[model samples]
Target: MQYYARIDRSCIRPAKDRQVTKRTAAEMDISSSIDNETTHKARSEGATRLNSLVASIYIFRLLFLAVCAAVRIQLDNGRYLVVFKGYPFYEKRAVRKGTAVICSCTRAQCNSYIHVDRDLNVVHEEIHHSHEPTRLIPLSNGRYCRSSNLPQMEFIEMANGKVCLYIDRYTFYQRSPRVWYCTNNVKCRSYTALSPDMRPLRMKIDHCHPPPKLLLNIFMTQRGKERLVYHDYTYYKQSRTRNGFRWGCTKNRWHRCKAYLHLADDLTIVRSNMEHTHSPHGTPLYK
Candidate 1:
């Protein structure tokens, strides 16, 4: 260790004071140089260790829910949870079997999540996520599935013959695209969008209100009283084969639309607009 310099001014020879001070200053410079070199070497070593650990890490799948998936990353003697780049990390303490809880992103510290019915389907999610984690980490296998791999459209089908389009679970459940029709709905010009809870939204209107259904609703004269054969809202029913419900034109309930629809559990409209309302514009040609 370098010591502090002390000089005696009284009875000290000029030549002696100069010599001693010069030597002390030179020693301090050398000591500072040595300390800097030591610190830099230590920092470099630490960085190398960290890089090695990151490179050797491996992620393994643990569990999967209805929409969310779990993974664990291990490298050397350390292990960590592998979550989506911007999603919140749900620890064991925070997770409950069937609760709707909000979670912020573990890294990005933005947004929330909701797990409903224990399936943990995203009831609501933020449009933007702050954490943009590294997408790709090369594994031992040349061909492996990871975020870095090429993106492709994924279709999720339910047992009922409906289909939904999704890019990935990261997009959240509410944002996933679902097929819808306006054959039985009063609001015919509405855009196609799933509700925040991943359920269909219905717009209520008066019975006589026109739904812009020029094709389905040809102004039928029922016993000299003009009536709408099919409403504007599409309809849905439990599918015979699939676990989910089948969607169709709501006019099927009245048996007037005569439309045939084969809806799949995945929200796909396999068959749509099955010949509802035979009248070109009205029921009677000469009423």
Candidate 2:
């Protein structure tokens, strides 16, 4: 005698495939909140594991996970976690992007990072760090912990949990008069704008500027022919000059605009002529 069992079709569905209900703006009681919570090591470990598991998923859902006041938003373009201000870390969201997101650590010296699309797919990743990562300093203003030798922007967590930019003596003196950028090197199509007062502004300031367009391979250009046109002058062929590297736009790669930049050793664009093809409507520039 053969026995038959009715099977549930949804039992094998992916964990990320479940429906995610997004709370309305009014639902979050933490609009401009000051997160005073300290994440226990266990919670941090949970977040770390959650991040790793999400990174392994092929298809992602619109997900939101909050661990110790830090919010993680999984979008169609990338997976981003917010290390809100006033905490030990300061992470913001990467608006939607169309291009494949790659790790920002460009130098041959850097390698242990991954870039995931909003759908949580690992589009590009690498592990090139030749040295131990910087220790997590208690209440430090810098974002990523690093033994970085780059001239990068350091934003300070405010009393209200928002952030304002901070430029140390080395960075300020090294790249004076240059506007700062929050790009993941020149590898991804995500950029954050900062106000003159060093306030990290939303990319939608006046008009939405497209993200930097180029790969880290440009650093390995053998011919030395790759150049960027900034201020009507084409430059950015120099490497190993600053504490980091610098480059200009590939003539608004796939767009009609002129913008350029200088990056720090930490792979952050220090200065540029901010112009883009879209407004801050919260949409990806490309699909």
Candidate 3:
């Protein structure tokens, strides 16, 4: 008896069907990977765009702040002013608990005004004008004045070869290319603002003390020798050096005074010791 091997057809798949199944699975995987890559690319592009937008906003904000600073100016008298377009406005009143200020046109008849916040942002404005805009000239002292009222400025050469700004009777020394401080900067808050060309823009003439006075006087003695008179006290030459001369008080011998002074060849007081044991003799004849 010829017996054929038992074949289980249900356990076997066609080669074509198996191949089709494997191809379908691989296609699905490729499609899923393509989708994942597309999603990741999209996210990356979005993040890049967001960063660029933020940077642009930051730059714009900086530019806005610069513009605000240019418009709002503080005067040397502690007053604030706002310049819009070509017109100038003075502070009229403050509202919102001093957080906001209302500025009015300089012209009395004009109804134009602006409301500015503490940050100098103009929140409200009425820019109507009744007359021509007032022209203002910036001063070296961080103040502004009418163009027609600009003062004449003078430049003087100091003894040490440094140049100083002289306006009225006050003197200012250069502190920077665009600013000058009062000669008495220690106690004075005065200063002058200068333009790029070193022209005086504004001046603050507030001085804490009066101008310095010359207190040392040169006197000729009967022996044709030179003597120094300071504050009614007389000083005679004690010794000489290359840089200067040392002087002793006239009463050094009798009163044993220890006071002395070092005077330069240019008559400049280099150093001094004024511990006198006695009072000044009399009024200086030279003075």
Candidate 4:
């Protein structure tokens, strides 16, 4: 009875293992099919979105180009003026005031417009012209004229805030070759031409010979030996006396302090201490 039971149990084990293997294989197939379907759906959705975005962009670009084609620009007077579609009133006022204004302009409108009048009309019959004559000012770069014939030019404001002409040149004025004779002294002549803007050039003491240099001299004695110091308005570069003594950077140079000496350095104490001890002015020394 035991041998028969063992043979039946062994036969049942093989059948059960085969059924488990079949179930696992079927589950794997179903999972793979679901994953494939999900991947296909995701890819289709992504493609549709991408196509829609590209189509929208194309439409927007086309609309923008069409709008741009409808707008144009125009010039008025000497200034290049443009007719603004939106806020037309503001733009007109800005143009009249010579102020900058922005307007919605398009490329097609820009090309379609043509300049009717090349010349600027100041008034009807008077034909308002530039009152100032064309001035040819020599520049470091080259010669330039106030007329529009020059390559680079611009409107400049004067000190009074009035309109003036400006050129894109380095130096505007040149050294006039004409020699101006001094009315006071016929012998004297000047090469530097003063501007017409200032008062008439007058003969001054500086025009004399010896070109005004600092008298670097020193003095020791009080009589005829006293050095005549020719000092201009500038304090630092003052001419020194001839008697081997003058106002130097240090107090050691001046034998007698012409002015009240400030105690600037330790060396300044030399003269002060000696003057105090000896009573140099014959005044009674302070106790």
> What is the C-alpha local distance difference test score of candidate 4?
0.31
* Model 1 weakest lDDT span, ten residues long: 166-175
Error of 1 at 253 (Å): 23
Query: Tens digits of per-residue lDDT for model 1 on 133-207?
Result: 433332222222233332222333323444433221111122234533333334333223334543323311122
lDDT of 3 at 217: 60
lDDT at residue 253 of model 4 (Cα atoms) = 30
lDDT per residue as tens, model 2, 194-244: 446543333211113443322332221223355432222333444554566
Candidate 3 lDDT tens digits, 134-159: 66656555566675554444565555
TM-score of each: 0.20, 0.17, 0.39, 0.23
The TM-score ranking, best first, is 3, 4, 1, 2
lDDT-wise, the better of 1 and 4 is 1
Candidate 4 worst ten-residue window by lDDT:
84-93
Candidate 1 segments exceeding 4 Å error? 1-24, 27-34, 44-48, 51-287
Tens digits of lDDT, candidate 4, 73-140: 23121232322212111122223344333332223223222211122211111112223322332222
Model 1 TM: 0.20
Task: Name the runs in model 2 displaced over 4 angstroms.
Answer: 1-99, 106-108, 111-113, 119-121, 138-287
Ranking by lDDT: 3, 1, 2, 4
Count residue pairs with overlapping backbones in model 2: 14
TM-score of candidate 2 on Cα atoms, chains taken together:
0.17
